[model samples]
Structures are given as structure tokens and as C-alpha cells.
Target chain A: MIERNGLQSGSQDPAPEGALLPVVQVGRPADVPRGRADAARNRARVLDAAQALFAERGVQAVTMDDVARAAGVGKGTLYRGFGDRAGLAMALLDDRARAFQAAVLDGPAPLGPGAPADDRLVAFVLAYFRFQADHLELVLESEAGRGPGARLAKGSYRFWRQHVAWLLQEAGAPHAGTRAEVLLGALAADQVRHWLVVVGRPADAVAAELAAVARSLLR
Target chain B: MIERNGLQSGSQDPAPEGALLPVVQVGRPADVPRGRADAARNRARVLDAAQALFAERGVQAVTMDDVARAAGVGKGTLYRGFGDRAGLAMALLDDRARAFQAAVLDGPAPLGPGAPADDRLVAFVLAYFRFQADHLELVLESEAGRGPGARLAKGSYRFWRQHVAWLLQEAGAPHAGTRAEVLLGALAADQVRHWLVVVGRPADAVAAELAAVARSLLR
Candidate 1:
């Protein structure tokens, strides 16, 4: 297991700490004990339930009690697993971010490996826009009041910045570092929400526009 | 005088409300009363003193008492005018923003009118980057805890967005609306602080790169 750093000290996820790393089953073997296996199942169920509830009714409208009820778990169990609403939101985003990272790291071409840098960059922007569109509320909740630069501290943000910079460098783009930050800045959750909810732009249209802009920057 | 809208209801500036409009001296004739003239002079002194102290010692390091002393105004007069540190910062930003807006509206060539759209956009980005660099700390303080999308509500932000959108439209860029938001997102004060402070990049480098990217989008 990777050693937990002070950066994620605020995290209450029961899972392993490294944000970009795969969630490792450290001690559990194939012959897992019944109670431990049950706990894992319960965690998955709770997450699924929370995701559905949040998507259906919005994050603010759903409470811990509601999450517990939807998950078929007691309030005590829910509280023990995820300390609060913020903790649950963080955990949920952590889960999705890890999966997304995995796809970018090892999945198909363009978003993954074995594609031209410009194409990969375009794919990455489109995928990230969709990710933000899907989880805009949760991302906002997970990031709220953490100060403006808090996102820069996230492992996921650092990973994305590095990946984008790498792609731009591979594409021989000048000022890759600053350009990566500018590209990611466009995907900031609050800005996405403003475009989607406040501005009432269609998600596909916004995402396509951003993708086009990303491709243009590489040119 | 324009009616004070609820959008700037939070504003504490004693000056007239419209952010883009020049500060009109309502009811003050050419031959103004000595007392009112002195009050205007004192206000200018306070703002000037605050700006210098903030630049020299950083916004957080300086206090209202220092501003009062530096401006040679009483603490009571300072507090009565500005309400608190935040209020003072807002007023300071408002003063600067108005001046910047004026430059954009009427000042010479690239930054003002009578230039190609692409050249105007590049100038706007460079000027905005310099503006953020000069006032990073105060902008951060004034915007703290106001929410992620709070900047969108600012009259100055709206004005800039419209101006950028107009430029993009004139330049025949597709999705000018979304592109304008993307361009302005790069100039978000928090992101600018990250680039200038956390990333330790020179303001000129960052500004130039952004200007280049802005020019690219118009192509």
C-alpha cells in the first residue's frame, strides 16, 4: 500500500489512500472471511445507492438517512463507512476518478495509449468534459469552501496536469505546462455547472466546443 | 444614477454602482462644497494608501489600521467608509476595475478599439493577466467563500465576457460564447494565483502564452 500523505489527510475513505493508484485489497485473499466479504458488498451497495439517489434527486436533497434507506444498510453502518455527506461525496468522486484514470492509463487508444498526442488530447478533453458534466454537483460539493487552489492539491488534478503536459510535449507544443493548466482550468467543476445549469447549454455542444478548442491549441 | 441591482447588493463601495460605467459624481457641481470635496479627496487618499500598503506588504499582512494611518485618516473614518478589510478590498478592486474597463473602452489601439479582433483579444488577455498579477491577493480575499460561481455574477466579469464574445464573433470563431467563457476561465483569479505563486512562473511568460493561445483560437 502506498503511504498516505498529508495532502489527503482530510479524506475519510476507508479504501486505500493513493488517488491514482488502483484500490488494492491489501490483506484480503481469494478465500476471504464471510464478514469482510459482506462488508465489501455492503460498501458497493451503499455507493451504488448513493450514486443513484444523488443522480435522481441531487446531492443536496439526499441525506445520510436517505442514502442508508436506499442502500438497505443502517444509519450506523453508513456513518461508520463514510463520516458525513462531504466524506461520502469525496469517496464517490475518488471511486470514479480512479476508474477514469485506469481507462486513460490502460484502456483503448486516444484516451489511453498508442494514439497521436493531438488525438489523445482531444479525446481526453471530451472525456473529461463528460465526466464533469456527469458529476458536476458532486465535484462541486467535494470541492466547496476548500479555497480556490484546493483542486491543484488533488492527486487527480496533478495526474491530469502531468498527463496533459506530457501529451503537449510529445506533440511538440511550446509552453506545455501552462497550456495544460489552461486546458484543465476550462474543466473546473463550477465553470461546468455554470455552463450546463446557469447558461443552459447542451452538454454535447459544450463538450464538443471544448474538444475543438483543445485540438486547436495543439495546432 | 442607475438603479442599484440586487447583484451588487453585497458591494460596499460608496461610489456609484455600475461596474463598467465611469464613477459619476452625483449632485457634485463644478463648484463643489468644500466639505464634500474634502471627503472625495480623503476617499482617494484612502484607496491610494491601501493600494500601496497592499502592494508593499501583501493584502493579508496589511490591516485597516495601517491603511487609516497611511492615508492620514482616522480609524473611525476608515471603518465608517469601508465597513471592514473585505469592504476595503472590494472598494479597491472596484476602483481598479472601473479604470481598467475605461481603458478597454476608450484607450488606444490593441486593448481599446480600432484594432483587428485577434489583436484585440491578445491585448485583452495580456492586460487581464497583468491586472490579475498586480491584484491577486486582494481579489482572492474579496472573493473568498463567495462560492465557485460567484465570479460569474460580478458585473465586471459579465462585461468582460460580453466584450470577449463580441471579439470572438467578429473574428468568425465558432462557438464564440463558449470560447469566451473558456478564455476567461484561464484568467480566473485563483488559477492566476496558482500560476504566478504556486507554479512560480513569471507573469510575462504566462501572459504571453495565454495571449498566444487566445490568438490561436481566433484562427
Candidate 2:
């Protein structure tokens, strides 16, 4: 079932051309070779254990040995699967990211296709923040050394940009592409985590602010 | 005179705020501390040499020895005055950065203070891109290790944000703060360089698009 992440959503509308997350990109989909049931199962088990342990102790404090032990897998398999902690973090992000793209692409409204463009825009912001909150530590660590503007080149980033641009165009907004990029800047992972965690602002306040920004821009 | 950056041909009104290039921000405005004319002269000469060398060879390729030789200063003076190559890069950036801030802060109509808010906003985008173009290599080098987001916390960044927010409010734009931040995102050093160099979009085209976005938003 998880393998279906590689498959498109039921949307008649196609995903962007050539947008499968690059193998080098964080959270590239699980392109596990078919018929590797055992490999897939082991992979999932490791991820589940890794997520629990990392969330319990935080990403920095958790060791690979601990994850392998908890997953009941050989250390060799852990290394072979995820390569290192950064790789593991990216893999976990990949799983959640894939699920998110699917849900938004086809799951349900107002996040899916059925809601008004304005509502979908707000819903996307709220949903994206929650995702950022859940993976705060992972994202901050994983993105180290990638320059700030560098994230713009990511497949996931492009996807969200396209989504926002489409909605802006739907509402007859001028300069939708540039506006979408600016709007999307508000949701940068580094900035979001800083506001939520460092500044200790509740997620609700930030969401309210973003929704307000969207309303102002889209109005 | 520096004041000329502010006064336009038709404007009877002078520019706003005490906005001259501060001596401290770039070179501490001749902190000669009395009876130190020789030291000031050497400092000025070194900076002139550094500016020309950096512009010619790019930041990375130039070395401390090259600067010292070019300026006819002893190596000790160069190190004592600017610390190292990185220090020199920053000092050079500071010089230009201060000039830019001054010009926009109080120079002439449009960018300075006398123009309408919307014109100021458009003029700002155009002027900022030109500034970025002038110091692209210096900025990229000077701002390294400061995460792209980290630049947001700098004093210079705060000043720009405040300026933009003030203008947005003057025009009765809602969410002025958030909108200002999003607007400023397009001017980030990393992203600006990427857009200008990587995407190969002409600065004028990008500026026009941004002007259109601002127009739509403010309307």
C-alpha cells in the first residue's frame, strides 16, 4: 500500500512534469523495487521505530544503534537502508511529505479539490504549519548546509509554489507567480520553526497571521 | 555632495530623516579621534585599493597580500585595520550598504521620501536590485554561515523591513508587517543572486513583475 506513493493520485490533472522527488532530494518517494515485500516491511518497521525514538528523545540525542535495536533489525540493515541519521530524517520526511501531497491532491476538501480557492489557500497554510511543527527538529537538522534560497529548488517546494500559483490565477490575481513565491516565503521551514519554537508563539497565532496575509493578498 | 542622492530636479521638499551614509557603519566615518590624519589617509587608501581589487578579481580570488601591495600599505596595517580577507570583504560591503541605505532613506523623491507610497515601493524594488547587482559577489561571501534566514535578524534587515512596513501602512495596506516581509523576500541576497544569475531573468523584468505584484496588492 505504501508503495502507491510512487503512483499518481486519482486526479485527472497530472502532477507537474518531471517532478518526482530526485533520489538526492530529501523525501524522494519510496521507489523500492517491486516484489521486495520483506525489504519494504523492514523499511517501514525501521521508520516507525526511528520516528518514535527520535520524537521521544529528539533528533540530535537519538543514535542509529538505538533505532536499529528498537526496530529489531540488524545494524547492517539500518545502515544499508538509511545510510546515516540525516538520511534517516530525510526518509521519514519523505513518507509524511508523500502522504501530504496525495491528500491535498486528491484526499478531500477544503484541502482537496472541492473548496473555493481562497479556502484551499488558507487550509494549505494551516496544514503546512502543522506538518512543520511535527517535524521541526528533523527539518532544521536535515536542511543544514543547504543555503536559504536553495530550498526553492526542491521538488516539494516547487509543488507548493505551483499549487499556490494555480489558486492565485484561479482568482484572477495579477502576477500570480511572483505573488505565489512571496506568499510561500511566509511558510519557509526555518522561519516557521523559529516563530513557533524559538519565539514560543502558539501555532494558532501564526496560522491566523498567515490566513490574514492570504486574505489581504487574495482580496 | 552626498545630499545630492536625495534632491530631485522638481522636488522643492528635501528628503526625510537624517539619512546620510553613517561613518561608523562602513568605516566609522573617520573615527580619526583628532590628530590622526595619517592613519585616516592610510585607511582610505587601503579601502580604495580593496574596492578596486575585489571588483576586478571577485572576492574569493583576491588575497590579503594583493590588497596590501595594491594599497602601498604594510601587511601589518592591512591585518590590523581589517583583520583578514573576510574582514576586508565585510568592510567593503559595509561601505556600499551604508551608501545605499542613505540614498533610500533621505536622498530624493521616489526612493528618498517625497514620492507617493506606491512609487516609493516600486522605486525601492528597482534600486535594491541594482544594489544587489553592484555587490553580488561581496554579499554572497560576507553573508556566508549566516543562514539565509539568519540575515533577517540583522540590523540592516530590520531597517529595511521597518521602512517597507511604514510605507505599506501609509498606503492603508492590511497586514503591513507580513506583506512587507514577503515583499522583502524577493530581495534576499541568496534568492536575488539565484534569480538573476541562475534563472538568468533580467533584473528589469523581475522588477517589473514585482512592481505589478505590489500594484495589485496595494490596490
Candidate 3:
């Protein structure tokens, strides 16, 4: 579902002509053609177990032992699939990121591609805030210890900036790319989480204000 | 200096039809004396020490012991003076907050009193981002654990929100108070720190984008 949505959403770039899309494909030369049925099943089991454990005990508290037992797989199999906690966490975030990408890119108008730029931007920011609220610990852990939200990759960050940039361009921003990068930078996941979650305001309310701010900032 | 600026700025609503100037104390509460010179001097020394230590080690790493040593005061004296590290941090934030309040409320035109509502709002948001950058650690720690930023009452979160609310009302927002609350809620110190310090954007750039966004949202 996510893949289908991702592809459709990816096409929403009304770039002037032939602008390259920014998705980072990590699979490469040494990669095998495909996983066997059993391997795929194990992967799914591990992911399900990891998500449940993370939700219950938080990302920091859930251990590989806990995951192995919950998934009904041996510790060795679990390690083989995800290597370590960070790897498992990253895998989970990847699933979410892909899901989120699909929602914004292809799910519907407004959040997707069919609506006006201003409305789309508002929808996307709202969606982003909702996602952050739902996975607060996961997102915070992903970016913690090195300073809040320090580990999010540049490419991932660019994805958001690009989304905002597209909207800004649609909004007739004087400098779409640069302005999008700057404006969206202010509405980061950690920032939203801090305000709506940490600071105890309703997430939807803050998201609405953020959307309004985005509207104001863009052209 | 701040009192001088407050009178000069006149940026805020006139002080409730001759509400005694902050300088003209109408009443004094029990336990808190009208003023004490020695206590004020000690407070200044401790704050100066905290500022110096903050510059050297940043917010996270500095300890109360370090603060005491830097200030050439005993640990007990430090505690007596500021209660705890959190208290000390809040005091520092208070210093900046008070300065900011004076600047925005009374310092000069545009940010203070003389400019159009739109221009003042833009300047205020931009000034806010700059303030967050200047005191990143204290700002983050203030909103650190969870819930409302109640712990950091020493800072300008409430004040900023109220100011924005007033501006929104002046700019013709229906339910201006609620709108301002949402707007200020959208721009917490944690979010600004996450973007500027953690995400590595220049403060000025973030300010400009935010100012633009504020303009658009208000419009």
C-alpha cells in the first residue's frame, strides 16, 4: 500500500521540467535478489514484536531478548535480522517514514497532490504533527543523546524541506526552495513534539497554528 | 535600563489606564521584601557565574557545584540563593525574559510600540527566535521533561503568548486570545532550539522565515 502511494505521491512534483526526485534508495550491489518466504516471515514477526515492545516499554527499555521472546523466534534469529537495537529502531522508523511518505504523497487530496498548494501544505504539516504525537518516544529516541533530534539524516530532512518547498512554490513564494527549507525547518518534528506534547497544548491546535504560520511564511 | 526602554518602547497595550509602572510598587508580599541590596548583589554574582559557566560548558554539562565554585560561593549559599540547578536556570531565563519584555514592550519602535500591528508581530517573532538561539540550553531545559513549560515561568512564554494575542486582536483576529495562544504554542523554545542548534540552521535565516510566516498567518 505504501509503495503504491509512494510512487503516486512522488509524481506530485510540478517541477518546471525534469527535476530529479529526492528519494534515497539504499539497496545495492552486494544485496541478494530477494529474501526467501521464511526470511520475510521472520522479518515481519520481528518488526511486529519490536513495535509492540517499543510502544509498551519505550525504545530505550525494550531489549533484544524481549523482542526474541515476544516474536517466538530465537535470539540468534532476531539478531541476524536486525543486528542491534539501533538497527531495529531504524527499521521501525523506516516503516513509519514510508507510511508517512505514502500518506502525504498519494493518500488523498490536500495531504496528497490534488489540492491547492496552501491547503496541501497545511494538511501535510498537520499530518506531520499527528505522526510525531503518535510516535513521540520513537522519534525522540531516534534523535536523542547527541542533542535532541540530531540523528535524522540530511536526505530525510530534505524530503520534508522539499515538500514544503513545493507548497511554497505553489503559494507563489518568491524563493520557494530556500524559503521552504527555512520555514519548514522551524516546524520540525522535535519542535512540534516539544510544543504540543511536551508543553501540553493539544497537538491539533498547534498543528493548525503551524499551518497558518506556513501559509503566512510562503508567498 | 529596562525601565527606561519600557517607557520608550510603548509597544504594548497602555498599562491598564495608569497601572503603576513596574517601578512604582503598589504593594509588597510577605517573605518577599520590597528590595534588598545585598541579596540583589549576591543574585547578580551567582547569575554572572552561571553565565560564564554556561558559556564554557554549555547548559547540559554544567553542575551546581561548578556554578558555586565559579561564583566563589559555598554550595549552601548557592542553593540558598537559587534553590537548585533548575532554579538557577530559571533565573537566567528570567534575566533574558525581563530584558526581552522590556525590549518588546518598551525599548523602541517596530518591536515595541510605534509600528503597525503587522510589522510589530513580525519583529516580535523574529526577536523571539534570536532570544531562543542566545539561550538555547536554558530554553531546552526549561521545557525538558514533559507537560506545560510551567517550570520556566521565569521566561517569556506566557508574556510572548499574551503579546501575540494582543497583536492578533489588533490585526482583527476573531477570538484573538485563542489564536495568539495557538500561535505562540507553535513556536516554543524547544522547537526553535531543535531547528537552530540541533538541525544547524542559522538563527537569522530562521527568524526571517518565521517573520514571513507570522505575517502570512496573521493576514
Candidates arranged by DockQ, highest first:
1, 2, 3
DockQ of 2: 0.32
Model 3 agreement with the true structure over A1-219: per-residue lDDT tens digits: 223222221122121211112364322233332547676677788889988988787776876798899999998787666544544554577656777777777778889888998888878877877777777766654434233333333345667777788788877876576556445544554555556655778766676766666666565
- Candidate number that wins on TM-score, 2 or 3: 2
How far off is residue A211 in model 3, in Å?
4.4
- Native contacts retained, all candidates in order: 0.62, 0.48, 0.20
Q: What CAPRI class is candidate 3?
A: incorrect
Candidate 3 C-alpha lDDT tens digits along B45-68: 777888888888888888878888
iRMS per model, in Å, is: 1.3, 2.9, 5.5
Error of 3 at A164 (Å): 1.5
Q: Which stretches of candidate 1 lie over 4 Å from their true place?
A: A1-57, A60-88, B1-88
Which of 1 and 2 is ahead in TM-score?
Answer: 1
C-alpha DockQ of every model: 0.52, 0.32, 0.15
Over the stretch B195-217, how does candidate 1's per-residue lDDT look in tens digits? 88987988888888999889777
Please give the TM-score that candidate 3 achieves against the real structure.
Answer: 0.63
- Alpha carbon deviation, residue B105, candidate 3 (Å): 2.7
Error of 2 at B147 (Å): 5.3
Residue pairs with backbone overlap in model 3: A9-A105, A191-B191, A216-B216, A216-B217, A217-B213, B5-B106, B9-B106, B11-B112, B11-B113
lDDT of 1 by residue, A101-176 (tens): 7778877998999999988999999999888888888887665534457667555577788999999889888878
RMSD of 2: 8.5
TM per model? 0.72, 0.71, 0.63
